[model samples]
Target: MRILALALAGAVLGATSALANGDALVIGNSRYTAVQTLFGAQRVAQAASALNAKGFDVTLVQDADAADMRRAFGEFAELLDDDGGPVVILLTGAFVHSAGGSYLLPVTGNGRIDEAEVLMQGFPLDAALAILSAHQGRAFLVLGETGEDPDLSLYLNAGLGELDIPHGVTVIRGPAMDVARYAARDMARTGRFVRRAAIEYELQIEGYAPQGQVIVRAGDVAPPRGAIDPPLPDPFANRAADDVAWRLAQEADSAEGYQTYLDGFPGGVHVNAARQRLSALNAEPFYRERRAEEDLELDRNDRRAIQRALTILGHDTRGIDGVFGDGTRGAIRRWQEETGLRVSSYLDRDQIARLQAQSTRRAAELEEEEKRQQAERARQERVFWRRVEDRGEEAGFREYLQKYPEGRFADEARAVLKAIDAQRAEQAVGQDRRDWTKATQANSVAAYNAYLRDWPNGGFREEAKQRISQLQLDADRVRNSIEASREEKAMNLNFVARQLTERRLEQLGMKPGKVDGQFDENTRAALRRFQDARGLRVSGYLDEQTMVRLLAGGIIGIDR
Candidate 1:
């Protein structure tokens, strides 16, 4: 029921399915009511899908009894059609060991025979494999279990421990090298998955090449002509098969060394593939081996793992190498002390697994913390802008310029400033217009002084000066126009006396007119008449005090 998102194109699927492959048979059993098969059933289906896709007419029989399994095996073996290639038998069920070699069990019912009765209840694993291998074509037997013997150590110690099988049987084990395993491990290993068992086998076979290649087998058919080449020193042809096997065996060091061997044997059958693997090997950092007598000190990979773990726990260890010499040990000890685990320099399997898991947990925690911090910074920025705006547009704009001179929103701030400036300028112009009218209507010199105090750089300075000059001229004309009235006569006589002699003008009641703002003879006669009325010598020109009196609302009533 696991949904796998495989990004392989249908074209690849179509191309793989069109390949002419030989016969293949797959057997799977999970409802045995014995040991719960976690991934066994799934693996069987996966195998079947992979084969089918690889242009193989794969026959997948699941949960079969003893009779059914034997019958299917017989039928598959009888297929002698020279169609595409060789016949392949892929069995993924339980293998039981007895005094008579190994046996493939049925779905239910024990394959065990008691002392009272002896019966061949189940098909023998070795016989089944042997029967398929005996054919005049290439054969393969893939299995996961090595042996389930508790005393495996004693057998290994005797140096006589090998579960023998056919020579061409290529075996793959564990929840490794496949998509689900790689994904669960976060290894990013496999890029795709083969849907059919035949295709899976093909891929396994073709994966032995440099580029990724998969092949599947269906029914018994003749193998393709160019598929099985004459064995030689062709590196490209065999690279995938060799690399996958090497990787599975955890012989990365040996595989890397093969790069040198391939380099030496350039004309070998697998030369191209060897060179490719060689290039890959050369790029990888050299991993040196330690002598048996050496101390149980940490290595680079160990240190890297530790560093990665420490980094997760908020300690920024630069790298993770297995070397727990001092820094890594110190970090581990610190983490152990914090987490209440045993504080030790040496890391056991459980400890290492814990460390790796902790590292991942710590990474997620760090990422979350960073996101929170960013959110806080953004909030603070918003608060700052709001506070500035509260101060008023001018202050806000000034603050913005100071804070972010080349900010993305600089243009927006400038626009706000420009609007405020324009508004202030418009208000200043309106006030200046009103001040100009008020200053013109005022008759006193104090009013003009007040207007000048209020508007230092008002726009109506020239207009106000002109209006004041005209008011002075009109006042002088009014005094000159009156010839018979006693006050007018006295004013004219005083004006004349002030105009004629400056000393006499001060003695007289009337002051002299200012020579400014007057051009006609009538203005001169008016000044002369005013001087005569005040009983002083006549002069048309006004004195400094007289001009001050004319300009500053100093009009006086004189005795006739």
Candidate 2:
């Protein structure tokens, strides 16, 4: 079966009395709360009649939830004896497997199966194998697999996984339809070789397989006393009916169509194909809607355009990239909600056109509003500039420049301010030069201080301060002129340094006697006059301070 593997071994003797009283548990679950219904799963319950006819006691459960399945399994276990008879279990429904083991899902299980949930709530295949292992050669397990592969979580996988069959327990497995039909018709037939029936129905057999193994013996097991078998039907008529039902089911191609075929012919040959179709049809609820959108054959550019339109309509698509990810899907859902369409998060041709039209209208409105705003701003700027021009003051021009540096009349305002600044600067420069002249004529520290107070930022401010400092030093030197002269004599000026000093003093309009290195009376008078004019001590002797001022025009070397 699509569920698990089975291997048959050991032969059962025709005289075995244990076959007279076999115990069988049949569970068929089709209606599920979470996943697609296995339409033919419930038909496996029909196998109970066959098991009973073969002198076997059977317990049947259909569309069972977790609790019901557990109760049924418990009751079936209680009926078994340690060494009584053959044991059979027929399970039909959805199954999931993981690394741990396989489980038979109850009707209440969801699509997102977890390991703990499966282990706790679902019936473990291991439990079934354990029960069958006790009966050994006479044990039979028939699993009806749905053959549906669903998307489960990481810890679980849909469908029956590989089986770890216990020795001596025979397992018969195939698609739900094949297993169901085999269980109903061939599983309990007297003198029927189980392996031959498995091969005929294309079911897989695993564990305890032998050349010839029969689960039921004709002589050992008789139909219950007073139980009369029904008259056999015409084989030809049955085939004709089966063929007609299958053809009609194929033509309808719907869940109901295939279900009808299943109800009428549970053991029909097309039962497997019909159940497969039914499972597929019920699996996808939005099949038609998804197909309609896909038929549009949207390319990347088309998807991007749709995203842009959705964004313009105030739906945040997260990005304008061509890929339609979760954000884009959410945006589509919102748009569909507003537009009174199915909230499938997918687009049909008409819906796309409507979205485009709405976005176009919105864009036009925004453009008009923007243009009106621009016109209003331009009007405000003109009004402000007119006020500034009327004032015609430097402060007004500056204020206008601060407000709108790139306004239309900004250049004209700048030019006018530049000319006005130039005129004021010329007047200020004239006053500054007159003040400097007065300060020099006075030639005192107080005069330089007055000049600084008037023009703190004047161009000659640094020079004025320096002269004031030099004058103060000269006054201090005059008070100690003898000691100052003694310091100068100690300098021991050479002929070249003395000659350079005399020449520098003459160049300053203070005529020394000659360019010779001797300090004559003419040289002394020139030195005293130069010192008096330049704010230096006027001792009429070549002191260190006087020599420094005299040689200010160039470099000089002296020994001290």
TM-score of each: 0.29, 0.38
Off by over 4 Å in 1: 1-19, 34-36, 109-119, 135-137, 146-560
**What digit string (tens of lDDT, one per residue) describes model 2 on residues 1-560?**
00110101000111111226678777776535432333333245347656665656666666556777787788788777554568899888778898888888776535444556667888888989999988888898889776444447778887788989998998888667567767767887888998899867657898888977888877657443332644333334446667567656744545788899999999876665566557656776754555466557564447657866786677766544444555678999999999888898878899999998987777666446545765786688789888988888776777776555445687997798778655654656788878988998999999999999999987556557656766875676566567656655644444655776687778767888788988787877787766655445666676644543333333333211
After TM-score superposition, the amount by which residue 254's alpha carbon in candidate 1 deviates from its true location, in angstroms, is 44
Instruction: Show where candidate 2 strays beyond 4 Å.
Output: 1-19, 31-42, 109-113, 223-560
What number of clashing residue pairs does each candidate have, in the order they appear?
84, 15
Q: Please give the lDDT score at residue 556 for candidate 1.
A: 23
Candidate 1 Cα RMSD after full superposition onto the native fold (Å): 41.4
Q: Candidate 2 lDDT (Cα, whole model)?
A: 0.67
Q: Please, what are the lDDT tens digits per residue for candidate 1 over residues 1-560?
A: 11111111000011131344456666654324322122322344455445544444455555556666766676666653455354555554445554445555555544233311212655566665566555433454544331121222211221111345555443332211132222122211122322233233222332112233222323322244354553233233344444343222222323455565554555543344344334433543321211110123333334444554564565433222222333555666677787787665445556667877876665566446545764675465567667767776566665665454333355777787667655654656777767756766775566666677788666544334444554565566456444223332222233322333333333333333453333246555555544333233334444322332232221221111
TM-score of 2: 0.38
Error of 2 at 278 (Å): 17
